[model samples]
Target: MAVTPGEETLGSRYRSLRDLVLEELRDQIIERRLAPGERLVERDLAEVLDVSRIVVREAIQQLAAEGMVTVLPRRGAQVAALDPDSALHLFEVRIGLESMAATAAAERRTDVDLARLDRLIVEAQEATRAGDRKRATHLNMEFHEAVVDAAGNPLLGSIFRSLSGRALQLFRIGQDVDAHGLHHEHVELVAVLRAGDAERAGAMMAEHIAGSREGTIERVRQLVAEAEAREARG
Candidate 1:
């Protein structure tokens, strides 16, 4: 939905304002433009986004509900931190959901769906080779969503998408890693699915996700320690 001028100015159009704010914030969060645990001053965000305080508050509350932001008593809101424990917990949940989805998709795979997945895999590889991290990440998401869609389970797909958003946030906070390795994993996953090996495909999917979680957690821990030392020295 388009943001109306009146809604933008008055911030009374809760639905549109809420969605717009979320979209903007989601991009920032995913890109790590707004780093984890960074304070989100409503006044600063309102001024920067050209929205009202009401809109900012509503948007932040929605993000909090999504587990993307945290609201603290007397301290206001900040981007949610990606601690090691939380990362492991979220990845465990994701591995279970995605592995099941991959198994179901292998069993229910259609020729058309396979073709689309192949195309996405190729696109992701090309993006990675060209050093376009944003496009690569976008295609990575599309490939996974395609698998979930092929599973023909709307509930499962919805859950995967939500969890994937959180995972993407964790991924972004880590240093820029080349997508080439992940692209190869995607290719192998497609091969397993095409061969109709549900068990093997599920195992591969789980392993791939687990590897990503491990890499991201390690990076986050390093960054956290560096930040702490910097603060101590100051």
Candidate 2:
């Protein structure tokens, strides 16, 4: 039997709602509203978000696949804790991937792409100046994503997006180190891209990513040490 238009519309609406919920939940996690190791209760979340449990379940499943959440048998879902080893591994891959993206973007970017990149840089700078760490982090992702999108390779875009969830945690932590400096780095990278020097752009991006990884790992080590101190005191 052919599916009716009404059925398709209803399904579309449901999927849209699910996506909105998913995005909101992801933001909450990234901003630490839902902290690492925090348990998520479906009924509570569904009620709070004014959605059905099914929608919450589907959204959580997607987040899990993205490495933002961990679903354990019998224990349900919780935000994934940041692990230094995993973070290092992720950044190792990102350094290579993002350098390739920078090269492609330098070669392929159009005037429209440059305009978008400029706007995002301005927005990111404003967010940092306003001391809005969460917004700054969100804009940081947008700026990098804009660069990757300009690369014009569907497979590259897919791989970049896949790494984004885990990287969000690192970005959030790295902000405590220097949000201002990070925005400054973005500005410098934009200049390199505008100059259309693919080799320089790629090298700069690789170094930028490596620096971020080091900062995130340093923060993680401090956090672990603090936790250990509290345990020893107890």
The RMSD of every model to the true structure, in order and in angstroms, is 4.6, 7.0
Question: Compared with the true structure, what per-residue lDDT tens digits does model 1 show for residues 37-120?
Answer: 888898888876677888889888878877889999999999887678887898898789889989998899999989999999
lDDT of 2: 0.82
Model 1, residue 195: distance off in Å is 3.0
With a 3 Å backbone cut-off (N, CA, C), the pairs that clash in candidate 2 are: none
CA lDDT of every candidate: 0.80, 0.82
Score every model by TM-score.
Answer: 0.84, 0.86
1-234, model 2: which lDDT tens digit per residue? 111123233234555878877887887787667867779888878766667889889999999999989999999999887678888888898899989999999998888888998999899888878888888887888888889998899999999998897787688878775666776788888888888989999998998888777778988787667766776999
The alpha-carbon lDDT assigned to residue 38 of candidate 2 equals 79
lDDT of 2 at 49: 68
